[model samples]
Target: MDNNGPAYHEMMELHEILNFKTLCLVKSKMMSGLVFDQDLKALMEKDVKQTTAAIQDLQSVYKPNGGIVH
Candidate 1:
């Protein structure tokens, strides 16, 4: 096993997490537009921002052959 990269199982798990976070980010952004309450909309926006960051971090760690997919 290579020391610098994640194992196969770990990479698969990370890929799943990245997909989930990407979905959450997209949903939050879309739903925020429909939210009437300012507080709820703000919260959803915050979630979008945080989820975006999480996806980026996950991509950084889960690179295959030193490159991200997107």
Candidate 2:
């Protein structure tokens, strides 16, 4: 980390990005239930799993400790 870490604007931007991703994850999960195609449902399941893991990683980055994985 540098002497100057992420600025307020950067943090705010990260927050917004995570918010959007979370929304997308939820919507995709909901749509997965409504979709009838087997392949599409599997894809949606994969998407949900990957997005959830990614979100956890991003949250670690947003943590005060600067991305300590646990």
Question: What C-alpha lDDT do the candidate models reach, one value each?
Answer: 0.80, 0.81
User: What is the per-residue lDDT of model 1 for residues 1-70, given as tens digits with 9 covering 90 to 100?
Assistant: 5565556777777778888888888889889999999999889988888888888888777776643445
Candidate 2 backbone collisions, by pair: none
Q: Which candidate number would show the highest lDDT if scored against the true structure?
A: 2
Error of 1 at 35 (Å): 0.4
Model 1 clash tally, residue pairs: 0
In candidate 1, which residue pairs clash? none
After superposition on all CA atoms, what RMSD does each candidate show versus the true structure? 3.2, 3.4
Which one wins on TM-score?
1
C-alpha lDDT (0 to 100) for residue 68 of candidate 1 = 40
